[model samples]
Structures are given as structure tokens and as C-alpha cells.
Target: MPHPRRTVMAVTSASLVALATLAATGSPAHAVDDPPSTPVPITTPDGALFSYVVNADTRQHTAAVKRAVRHAGGVVVQAWPQIGVVVAQSTNGDFRSDVLAGADGARVESVGATRTVPVSEGTPGSGGTTAYAEEKASGAGRTFDGSLVGATVADPREGEQWDMAMIKADQAHAVTDGRKGVVVGVLDSGIDVTHPDLAGQVDLDKSVNCSDAGKVDESLAGKTSLSGTHGTHVAGTIAAARNGIGIVGVAPGVTLASVKVVNDDGFIYPEYAVCGFMWAGLEGMDVTNNSYYVDPFEYYCEDQPDQYAAKEAVRRAVAFSTARGVVHAAAAGNSGTDLDTNTTDDTSPDDSTPVTRTINNGCHDIPTELPGVVTVSAIDQAGLLAPFSNRGLEAIDVAAPGRRILSTVIGGGYGLLSGTSMASPHVAGVLALMKSQHPTWSPAQLVAAVRAQADDHACADVTGAPCVGTDADNSYYGEGVVDALGAVS
Candidate 1:
């Protein structure tokens, strides 16, 4: 962003030196808990398949864990030795306990059923065995060369993009649209590549459907639900082309990888999320934007063994991405509450009946709350914090224009959507610009620069919610509203 030239993490193989290293790291202390209860609440009905994550202590011990999974009548769908995580399906209600109690049990760290509902996508066969390998070998998605010589800078519908002006993306665009190779993975509902504005932006080879037990499907399609345009909307905000046909994105010169993690029921399960993150690293993504939290639980607590194990598996997958130099940005949430002083959760086990369970400091929002991820909150056109955004003096890393954002929707058209989900892509776009400018900068350096360059402001009094901290840093605004122009200048 500073118009500086530096070293580059250019290619996929060159980008992936430490996937094995991340897998080699012994299990985290938090994952080494005692045996959890068998037949965890909300388990599948007998003979009904449920997806689970079986984690071993390290990559070297994954074989034993795989054997344990088979012994418990579960079929290993996919085994990620790099993260010591195995995505499996089982009809046995006691698979969770049985997998961690036999002779090979000591080699395993923890086992967890990733969701509350029975498998809707069905169990694994051997067809998906080469999907990931084939995808990696096929090629990457589309990327811009940052050339504006004959390109139209102003899109036909850009007049409707107030969010761009709010974040100063308009000013940044004059400096540079972005770079040629930066790929931002959109981990959400599947993005529609056929959309006029996104056809040239989405990387089809890099995109995959992870909703089916973390299996990689090369023939990826759009969202299964009629109401699912979330991924395409977020992609438009990040890198929709600057063609005359439609609205432009914040970093129109970058590329997008549509990593579908949301299911037909509109849920983002832990296994899907883990697969998305891992795919980002394996595919050599520069950044990833997570607009939703893991399903069924608004908060995954460290004390709950099942929750902890599932969360830990996801964490390991994210760590693998980070180690490969992938920067991550995530939405804080739309619950309209303080994540710093979390109290109660009435939205857990969303696949089933939700109960108002008392929560505490041990609880957390996955991905957004995970280490090394930039947590963003939502704001409106007036520069006021969105009332529905989750605020936190501890959790939030930045703020961005989110409410009533105009971007590409599913019907090969444009629409307005809100929530922190819309805000995160703006940050991801800014990060892409930063990477394009300073290709060799470490992820930490980029994050620090983004924060330091933010437009700091006092907390908004509009929400009537308590605003803590000074203008420089506050619960409602984090460092402040993300400054696109500043990030690139």
C-alpha cells in the first residue's frame, strides 16, 4: 500500500512450507482434556449418520486415530494429518467415547461431533479422494494485473456504493486497484460465478464445496438455499471487477476464491469451516474473509470437552493457514451484544431447539475470536456503529461500513445487505491492497499497519450501549473505521 516493492510469497508450493510443521506441533494444552461423556446431547438417532472430528495428539499419530475411528464403526471421510484432524461419519451414538477409549485411544487427543444434526449430505465414499489433489493441480482462480490503462475505473452502478466512499476505497482506487495475484478466499455460502460482475473475478479451480463433511468438490455450485446470496455479496465487496456493467469492489484488481462452507440449511458447521481454512492454505490464498460463525453454537467454551475439541480442530486448521502466510478477517457477529463481557447464550445448538444457557468468560465466537484473525464490526453510512453489530473492547480489531451496502447479489444483479458480514470483506480488500503493495510483509506487519492507519474516532452514542475506551480504541469501533485510502497510501 505504501508503493513499496519487497519480497513475495508468490506460488503455492513456495507458500506451503509449514503445513507439516503445523501438524507436527503437539496438541495444545487445552485439547488434552479427560474423556468426554458418551452420546453427547443432541447426538444422531441410531443408524442416522453424524459427522465428527477425531483429533490425535500430532500428525504422526493420525494413523492410530484413524484406526480408532474405524473400530468405533465410523468411516473416515477425510484425514488431515497436517492438523491431526479427521472428518468422519458414524451411525454409532457412542462413537465419540468409543474412539477415545480403546488401545489406540491414548494416541488421540480428543474426539467431537461437529454438529447437532444428523448428516444431511450423506457419508463418504472413495470418490472424493482425489478432489483436493486434482484441484490443487488444475490451477488458481482469476486475478487482475493491476492495469488501469484501458479499464473503466468508474463502474456503471458505483454511484450507488456509499460504502466505498465511507471507507475511502474510492480514493485508494486512484492509487492502484490492487495486485495481480492476491487471492482472497470467501468462506461462506457459495458465490455465483456466473454473475456478470463476478464471472471474471472468481477462481473456479480454487473454489470448492466443503459443506459435505469437509470433502472437496470441484464441481462447486451456488448456495443450496433460495435465500443464500451471502457469499456472492461479500465477494463483490472484495474484488468484483471494475467493468462498466455493474458496481465495483474495494480492491477490484484482486481475485476471489469461493470456498463454500455453508450448508443447505444455512449453517456453517465446524468441519466445513476447518475445511475452508485448510483449503485456503493449500491453495495459496493471500487472505480469507469469514462472515459467519460456526453453527449450532454462538459460543464455544473451553471447559466443555466436546465444544473445546471441535473448536480446537478448527483452530488448528486456521493455524495451518496462518503459518502459510494467509491473513484472515472475520465478522464479530450480528447479535448486538458485548463479546468482551459475554454472559448468556440463547442461540446455541441452532440445528435443534435452542435454550438460554448461562455463559461466562470461557465462551467464545470461533474464527473471529481465534488468534491472528482481524475481527471487524459494522457501521452505517453516517459513520455510526450499527446497532446489530457485536461490540467488544477485547474482541474487535476494526470497524467498516456494513449497513445497506450495495453489491452483487445472486440473480445476476445487485442488492443491498447489512450486518458485520458485509463489513469484513472491506477489511479483506484493504488487506489485499496492502499485500499487493508490500508483498513480503509478514501478516503481523500488515495487521499492525492497518490498525495504525485506521481513521480513529470516539465511540458512537447512537446505540445507547455503553462505549468503553478512548477515541483511539473503543469497544464499539475497535481501532476505528477501516481506512482504505490510508491503507494503500
Candidate 2:
């Protein structure tokens, strides 16, 4: 990590110009403006689906609720008044009987009110006891009441989540026939095995909670609220279960393996990050998506043997795994600055004497700055670069949809979220499509495909934008927004 001054000074003239242009012109494409007020139903590449939010907390009498829903011909998906989460479905696309009938005054907010249906074998309540109790008490074994009953429906990538839409649209060419499969390892927090949106897709058998394995107390199950929503969201984006009711992911047919590294505090111990990479490598995963980096305050770049050792370990692991055909993708930190840190002068931007700030604080620097990683930046639905995203000519590899992005959530729900955390999945999802298109593609070949087909444009002058095509290589925007339709072909 270098001081902010040095980080800013590292910006070359060409890179600056590109940044200026990107900011003015926005990203290469346009954001969807007329997306309906209701959430858009989506299908994951795997066939898993998701719907919108339904207010079921108001439903009091359990029997009355069932009868009402049955009268409307709607099937109650799942209910959790404690968290005010309920999902219902209708195969015929009838909104009233499907989501609003049984539960009186139940304001159906999203598209069809998505419900998660777990297809993973073994225990149905493996995610946590909290989730189990909610489902069990909601009449798990009862039959529908009658015409009021609505069959459960799966909706994938609902809402105005245009970012995921683009990614999914790209995969159609590679996986429409379902002849190929790709596994992506999401190294983040833990995943919710019982999430309905993740129905049929969570690889519970291979899932592990490495944060604090033996910390369960007598009063509670061996679980923590911080079980890994981040990982769950990333997994849903990559390959959510493709059954028919919840939101669909870009590569729903692909397999997702969860490997927890970051904790509730979102701080990933370098050692855990390294171990995650190593394990994913051994598992023969096709791609690995890392949406987090060491927090700036916790970054150690100088006089810290332990910190450097951890970084080196991760770097080595990345190299080893990539050599075996795993495409490693990491977010290029959230800080908006020039990421080049190897400075010739330790002085401030004013050319004053060097200070400690010039030597060791993580300024514009990021873990994505490391070599051999496909470091990505963030872009909005309108194809504009996110203002908070970091940039550098030599450090970044590419850009993707990151702002106001939508994906799966805990306890079978969905919402709008922003961050490079969201953007990285766009690339990972595209990579899955690439692998399916060319099952025999090497890691290098995949990278080449993306670079060659990227949109070469700049968005430098308009607030925060990507810098693309200003140079033969990449500056701030890398090769530019990844083109799923172009890259796969």
C-alpha cells in the first residue's frame, strides 16, 4: 500500500484522458429505463427460479390462511413472520389468487413473490435451525385448501436487476441445451443451504463453515447469523438452482462450491483466503469468484512480515490454481483512485519530503493489484463506472455491471445492492458461459476470449467512469465491459 499522493501521481496522461472520456460517454451500453415497477421474473441458467417479496406477516390464523390461499388457487411457498418473509407461486401467472388471496391484505410487492425450494438431498433444514422452525410451523405436511390454492412458482433474476439480465442473456448461446457444466467456487462468507431462491443448486455436501468450526454453545445450534450471505449471493449469481420458483442465475446449470474466507466483519485473514484458493484448486473447480479484499485499515504493506507473508501465500496459491485451469477473479478494491503503488518517490504529490503515508497505508492499492488475477472494476446498468471503484492502467484487467445490481438474499429473498462485490459476479458468470461453450478451454484461453471481445470505450469525465481503449493494453477500464454474446462466440 502506498500513500494517496503517490497513488494519484501514478496516473499516466493517457490513462487520465481515457478516464475523462469514459466519465463523459458512460460505459459502452445503455441501462434499461422502463423496467416494470414490479420485479421482473428470471430463470437461472440451471433452471432454478426466484420471485418477488410478499407481505405475509399479517396472516394470523394458520388454517384461515391455508383456506384463503387454497380458495385463490395459490400454494404457500414458505412463511417466516418473524422476519416478515413469505413466498408463494402460481404456475398460470395469476397474481391475485397466487400471492394475495389467502393472506388477507398481503401486499405483494415483487414479481410473484419468489419462494425457494431446496433440491439438495439429506436434511432439508441443513442451513440453520432458525430457518427450519419457520418452515416447520408453516404447515409443511398439509395439502392446499382448494381453488384459492396457488401452485408454487420459481422466478430467477427478478426485479430491475438488468446487470444479471445481461449476464444471463449471454449464457443462452453456451448453455441453452444444457450439454455442458462449469463449477465456480465462491470464496466469501457462508451460504444459506435452505434458501428457497437457491433451491436445487446449493451443494450442501461440499459446503463448509470455516470461520469458527467449534464455537456452538449448549443454548443454540452450531450456527451463526454471519453464516455467509455474501457467499450465498455470489453463488446465486453464478449458478443458483434452476428449478422453477426463485430467481435464476446467469449460469444456473453450473455448480457452485462455497468456501468461506471473510467473516461477519468482512475481514478476510490472508491465511484463510490462501487456504480457500488451495482447496478450490484441489476440487478442480473451473472458476473462483472473490468479491472482497483486505480492508484498507487492516492492510499491511510495510514493516509487517506477517502481512506480506500472507499476501505472498495467497499470490502463490492463485498461481498454483490458475496453472491448473482455474480462472481466478477478484474485485479491484472499492476506493476510487489509481491503484499503482510501486512508487519511485516516497514524497507526497507536492514533491514534499516523504512521510509514513507515502510508505505504508493502502491508498489506491488493492489485492487485485497482484499479478495473475483478473481484477475487475464496477459499472452501472446505464454502463457507467461506479464512482467508488478503484482504477489503474496496469493493475485492473476488466470492468462489469456493479451498481444497483440485484441477486439472491438470505432466507429466500431479493434486493438491490451496490459494490464491486456485485460486479465481480458478472465476470464470473460470463466465464462460466465461456467454459460451457468451450469445455476444453484452458484458463489462458478463457481470459483471451474475454479480452478480445470486450467493449473498448472510456468514461473518464462524467463523475466516475471506466478508462478503456486509450492504450493498446488497458488503463482504468481494462479491455472494457465484458461482452457475453461476443466472448462466447
Measured with C-alpha atoms, the lDDT of residue 410 in candidate 2 is 66
- Candidate 2 RMSD to the correct structure: 22.9
- Candidate 1, 1-489: lDDT as tens digits: 210001111223322332232233322222122222112255566788898888888789999999999998999998889998998999998887788777688777777777776877422221111011110111122333345322765766788889999889999999989986999999988787777778778777787788777877766343332226788888999988887667789999898988888766677778889899999999999999998888767787654656767888899999999989899999988888888765678766676666777654446788888888999999988988888888887778999988888877776777777888889999999999999988998778888888888989897676467888899999889999999999788
Worst 10 residues of 2 by lDDT: 128-137
Candidates' TM-scores? 0.85, 0.60
lDDT of 2: 0.51
- Superposed on all Cα atoms, the candidates' RMSDs to the truth, in angstroms, are 9.8, 22.9
Q: Which stretches of candidate 1 lie over 4 Å from their true place?
A: 1-40, 121-150, 220-227
lDDT of the candidates, in the order given: 0.77, 0.51
Question: Model 1, residue 410: what's the lDDT?
Answer: 76
The alpha-carbon deviation from the true structure for residue 361 of candidate 1, after best TM-score superposition, in angstroms, is 2.1
